[model samples]
Target chain A: MRSGSPVYRRGAALALLVVVLIALPSVVPAFFINFVMTQTLMLGLAAATIVFLAKYGGMVSLAQFLLFGVAGFMYGNAALEAGSRGLNLGWHPWAAVAFALAVTTAAAFLLGALASRTTGLYYLMLTLVYAVIGYFVFAQITEISGPSGITSIKRPELLAAPVSLYYTALGLSVLAYLGFRALGRTAFGLALQGMRDDPVRMASLGFNVPLHRTLAFTLGGFVAGLGGLVNVWWNGQIDPASIGIGPTLILLIIAVIGGVSYFEGAWLGAFVYVAMSTYLRDLPLIDRIGITEARFNTVIGAIVLLIMVLSPQGLAGIADRLRRRPTRPRRPAAGSADETEAAIRRAQLIDE
Target chain B: MTATRRRLPVLAAAAVAAAAAVWVLFLATDTPAGTVLDEPGAFVVTALDAVTFAGLLFVAASGFTLIFGLMRTVNMAHGSLFLLAAYVAVGVQQAMVGKTRNIDASEVGIADWLVPMLAGATAAAVVGTVIQQVFLQWNEGQELRQALITLAITVVLADQMLREFGGLAQRMVWPGAVTHFITIFGQRYATTRLFMLGVAVVIGVLLWLWLNRTRLGMVVRAGVDDRQMVRGLGINIRLVFAVVFFAGAFLAGVGGVLGASFAGAAPGTDGAWLLNSLVVVIIGGLGSIKGAAAGSLLYGTVVAFSPAYLPSQYSFYAIILTFGLLALVLAVRPYGLYGRPA
Candidate 1:
């Protein structure tokens, strides 16, 4: 797979992408670079958690936001000022974050243990039930979640500035993406992919389907937790509303819109979702149509419907198709050459 | 182990009740609050209210589970449909009340209530038909895709309802004759609730008879059991599916009207109802009328009694316990009490 100029081309492309992102703040408006990109990257991380499980584990869990919300609440309660909306642990930032991660991991594992026994719609419902329950549980506990929300979360010293925080999100997301890519190449990852395609066959091949799925779910939860931690830091607040059905659906929409099958799709989906949400109302077309801020859901819903019907693979899928289009013409000759090589090797082995 | 597994839900339910009993006992002695147990007369009243509320919740959840059982598609927008129906019912009721100026303002006649109920049911059924035909039919068997599509539909519908109806909460004013309070077990309770309970029972019985005896109901059950086989038998499966969808949606509309008659309808009610029905369906076996009934009773009892017994500060414990019950049920009987494992 790495035998030619394509590897170098890919490396150069990656380098250029990184350079553009780093230089984006200076080139573009601060609002677009900071508000848009920073928020979008954090959201993308959350969506990436969904995409990871959907792509590799074939489990479409609706509880990703639950993990995000749990971690966010933990951070908010521990790190935010005491006597505010929620519990005031007033722990150090690192200590609070460590606690958040631990709680999130345990919650994810427990949820996974319950959910992994089922498949398809049952699994969907199980996770959805968890999400709904999680929302209510968190919302109702006024002492922990507060009546309004936990607010006034101070960012850490090193990543307080919007630009620096953006960089941190980008760097963390890049690391996560690389980690996922590496994971996907390992034996366990290969087994997961195989299980996703045909779980019965994988099981027949001596794989522990439920355990693998649970592990994948745990990893997905961690990814989502990280996203939540960053998101809480970015927003400087955590609310029950942030973890409810609306946000969960938004995350799902973004993941599906960007292309649930690809890692890069999460970023693309988050970009589109953030852009549409933040900028769609100001569009001239909407203004001409007299679309108010209240009616934005109609537009978003219509977009979701259209995208689901016309291009279920989302924007990433479209990009993938475009990229593959140029290479399609040479596919037959390359396939024939490989076929001949395989035939010659087989014949030589038979003769021997 | 298998026998224990089968009995786990019942056991868990019993355990929950016992725990609740113990908590109420503690509250009665330890807590200095206005709990129902403190005033003995309130217990019966609370139980009655819970039963009535559960009756309405059951109507909505039965429809939800029916559609799912037959089609394997969760109607994510069932709550929106419920809310829409409530708005329609209220709209019709207001129109009638406006026309009847000669009559007393508080006294709503039978026509006012009946016509609105029919209107709401029809509107919801029509919407369900359109949804099934326009979007869902094409994506048959793609549960996730269909669910997403329905979610979008719900969002659109919910927004439209908000735009049209505004954000105000409106309750249906029942006929004045039936709205009065009556003594039940030495406690005064709204007669309208008793009427609602009776209506729910009648509807439940009718639904059962229709499913077991009527030709269409039999087809629906058959379709639920095996859609492909029914299709192979030369039955017009599409028509059956559309009909089932309409019936399910129609039930939701009926429940909405009933709900709004007392509880009132508002912007967030759709989400609340959707979650309520989903929880009920989860607790009761999905797709079973009996299961829906059982779930509603338990849910209604918990919701009703919690607010009555718990302190105002800890009222949200009801929601927590409801889902906790759900978790317990899932651990015991994953497919629900009556639901077959697919």
Candidate 2:
């Protein structure tokens, strides 16, 4: 139990995290528990959707926020009572949630199909255009979503308490993290990784590369929709401004800051972003510099730029470097490559 | 055989499109009485508006496509450069005339306009060069990194500009020489718009000549096609990259000045113009000047004409039509009309 094996260490870390989270509401102030912790969990979940796509699928998407917004919008429109400025379908809240997730998944699948035709930077541009177009469409279609958006989305009685909501968000985040971790070990996930490494080779190996990409994108959308569902319930409303380019970019910034390549980095980045945005302006140094809340974007931008320029791999990479610093470098023995090649050839011959 | 076969559907689509256009422009009578189709004068005005706006979009997009072609960097800050130039031009114009707003248009001379334009272009060019050299140069071949850096620069620039210039929409006073209205086809058109069109044509011709006849332009074209190969040929590609970036930024600045005079420059125009450039380049084909021109004209036409011809109740759907054009063009030619795969 006290061994220094990596698996044990990982298990211990996770258990400690669970214990800390479970005990947090009791120890921390209500404001911290409700606002900061809960908000961080929700944003972390949202950023996780981006991390999953980027890390596993080798696709950096700007449309995840749009999908999140879609789910919220669909849910709001479906569940709003009559006389509201939405579709006012008056469906049960649970049913609305299911419908919203379904819609988001389908929309993501379609977007993935269209966008998978292009790769790399083009993929980014296409998704960006889609998001921008969605923004305009939502803004212009005032009949469906009023200029101000839908409001008065009531949460279920079970999650009415701030602590319960916080715990729910925490549980969802943990599940999502574990699910993504497990997915990465699955055959489909490995194939997706291989496709990311070299799509042409994967396709030549008889893999349906586009289908896998689309499926991965759809899964990301569903997860993002879950985040959206919780976000709407917490905020009790959804608006165009919430899903605009500003929020879109902030999500990407959060993912990059946390470590786009690591699943855990999503929440880590979210925690930093939420805390900074909330408290940065109150800092004595920031106040003395005359940088008000209005100028917060500048600070954030500078930080992102610094992070990108210094370490493209993000905070996770920095931590990884720090943790591995004590390990001694091993020098390869001369002629080992020849022996390995001969062994591989012998194994291949035996298989044949 | 495949080329001809592909061309057939495209030809058929164009014919159907042309027929639809004719029906909308001349044959449609169910539209409201005051719409463009009902009035020939309105039709001419809208058409000219489309062309002038297309010229402006082309000017802004040309530089973007060039940089994208050579560097494979989207330069998301291109719109920021444009907006910055506009604000600078407005500020300089106001300072020269010693008035913040409502300066006498008669007193503004060519120097007043020309000086501000030059100042704006110079400022934008300097900023653009600095961004490229400082942030993007070291990360060559890392397209995503370059894009993200530019996006950060855009956010910072936008915030700073908003702080400095405030939220008011500002327009540069046009030169007295081109402030009058010119009549064409018996429809009065703003002379400033015609002047803009003329400037666009001049710039287009100059760029075409440079690209076809100059040594540096040849290298740029070659770089666009195969950058690694061009670098392997012992050419100083970094120098070319800097020169192209400078020119591109300079063009954006010019566009800023022109756009300010055409329509007022405001806080959110950066995002709007950025979207416009993206759509234009995507429609035309990435990295192709001719494609930019074609895409701009088509996009401009859709934007200008969609609202004019749509029913009053459906006017809001004009935006949908614009994006619909994008979707259609993308479906037909994924690389765009004149674009080739990268």
Candidate 3:
């Protein structure tokens, strides 16, 4: 969150967190990290994409999973059909990525074009209805189901190795996060901020507001779709369950828990969620914690409710507050409040 | 303007005829004309059954419409509330006659369906009030969060229900023996269906009367239009909302009992009915008393007859049809059939 501080200026706690993550492979048991890392990465990307919709385009679509589904299917079918047809187009990793992004963005464009016509809750309902429609179609379609969802969708050749695949996903996520940060400060991003602030003023300025709105959706679609693709590859197959309305809601929970304003919040949320699931699944102490594995959802739901009530600004805000808190000084007996005061002054001056 | 208005019925009649012709063509091609299709009474029987189911659907959906329309909130756990009530009613009957399943209908000996109905309604009201107070009241204006939180609750509840109730369809043993089958123009049908239909009619009419003719109804109507203003006037908005939720849930419970009586209660009914109500309320008009009625009848008729007339494999086709209808209605009247345009 305070990436600008560098190692020396970085909060000692964050440094410790980084160290823990780096050494987690050795410290934690193998299976937990494997499961946690995988799930966190998948959901993080999905929820991170949701941040773009909420912060930039001012959309809250419950049916955003439709876009995610489109991405997964595109990759799966491309891989299956191309591999069978002996075409490198499907087998090639980049090619599959391109297809996924393209299809997702295109569908985003179509949906955005329709959705952009309305505002507020109407847009949400339309998006939700469309997503449900898409989910039903995919579930019912003989082509997709085929007894089991995209069966034999073997791990691809390039990112076949789990550890290697993990790194690649992690890398992509970092890149996507950076992309979001950069775009949030750009002119196009500024225009989007304008739409969120006052669409009437933006539209009256002849800014093709609807087109920009559509592009925002397309952007959301691209990120979510990419997440879907990675998840499919990670799981070695895509099941109908992979892209249900329920999972989409879970992604929303992640976004809500992690603070939707900062892009990194998505990663943090995903990480927490996956860890929770893993802990619930494997740990016996979860029962002692008053939640059985069977009752894990209750725990997760409670946590989400608490987060929304307590710190709706999410993990990102917490990160900001921690970063702003004064660091340990060389001089003994210097209180942390002094640093916080200094930081507050700096923020005030910056605002001025 | 007067002449054009007067001719509206003529235009409507012509359109209805055209639509009927199309429906006939679709059914004729889709359904097989065998023993099941024979007996002219079969047509009458099916229509009556459809109407009965439609009435029940209307009762359930009106609750859905009222909540969503007024609050702009989607109660994803609404179906669970419905199913829980049915389960409550079942628990009552099961106490009378041991075992919740596969009992002879004649063996059920209890006085007046009213007692069980009251129990179902009361249970539903308490449960609904609790949910509203606990989860919904805090998240009043937070639409997506409310939907999702309730969804999580629904999932947890559904799993827990399945575990407790055992994944079997349990019958709500009706009071008194359904000793005789009622024949409507020589079409034999269950007495329960007729009774359920009567229940639906009474519920619908009573609700309509309550909403329109009562002071509380007037206040609720005013509150629906502008909640902030109502609160400003020192009205206990929260209490009114509790009442609305209770009434809505109680109605859903009524539908659940009636539905369970005929269709049998099983797992997954919550989701099915929830989705169906979404289509119903959205199509008719969210929050409009009349809209829920119209939407339910329209939806129920299509759902009931579609199976008899169309391919059985496409039971889900009913869902798609509802979706299409929702879109069409929203297109024509973006606020739903009776919703006030923004």
- Model 3 chain B weakest 10-residue run by lDDT: B30-39
Order the numbered candidates by DockQ, best leading: 2, 1, 3
lDDT tens digits, residues A1-352, model 2? 4456976888789889989999998888998888888888888898998888777777788899999899999989888877558898989888898999999999999888766645556667777777777787777777668568889988766788868889989999999998998999899999987766656566667888768988999999999988888889889998888887778888888888887877778889989998998888778887778788999999889988998888776787678768877886322111122222233234324323
Task: Please tell me which model should have the higher DockQ, number 1 or number 2.
Answer: 2
What lDDT, from 0 to 1, does candidate 3 have? 0.68
Q: Please compute the TM-score of chain B alone for each predicted structure, in the order given.
A: 0.91, 0.93, 0.85
Candidate closer to the true structure by lDDT (higher is better), 1 or 2: 2
lDDT of 1 by residue, B1-342 (tens): 266655776787789778778776555443323444565566678778889989998998998998998987788889999999999988888888885223342668878888999899889988987998999987787776777788888888888998999998888877776777777656777788988887788889988999999999999988888899999999998898898899999999999999898788998788888888887887787777788998899889878876667766667676776766676777766667776553
TM-score of model 3 vs. true structure:
0.80
What tens digits encode model 2's per-residue C-alpha lDDT throughout B1-342? Answer: 266765775786687588757867676565542434467777788888899999999999998998998888889899999999999999999999889988766879989998999899889999999999999999887777777789888889989999999999999988888889877667778888888998889889999998889999999999988999999999999999999999999889998998998898998788778888988998898899999999999999988887777776777677788777876686567668887654
The full ranking of all candidates by TM-score, starting with the best, is: 2, 1, 3
RMSD of each: 7.3, 6.2, 8.8
Compute the lDDT of residue A263 as modeled in candidate 2: 74
lDDT at A338, model 1: 23
For residues A136-230, write the lDDT of model 1, one tens digit per residue. Answer: 88878888885577888887777778788789888878887778878988999999877665565666678887788888999889888988888
Distance from true location, Cα of A222 in model 2, Å: 1.8
Per-candidate interface DockQ score: 0.27, 0.30, 0.13
- Classified by CAPRI criteria, candidate 3 counts as incorrect
Give one clash count per candidate, in the order shown.
0, 0, 0
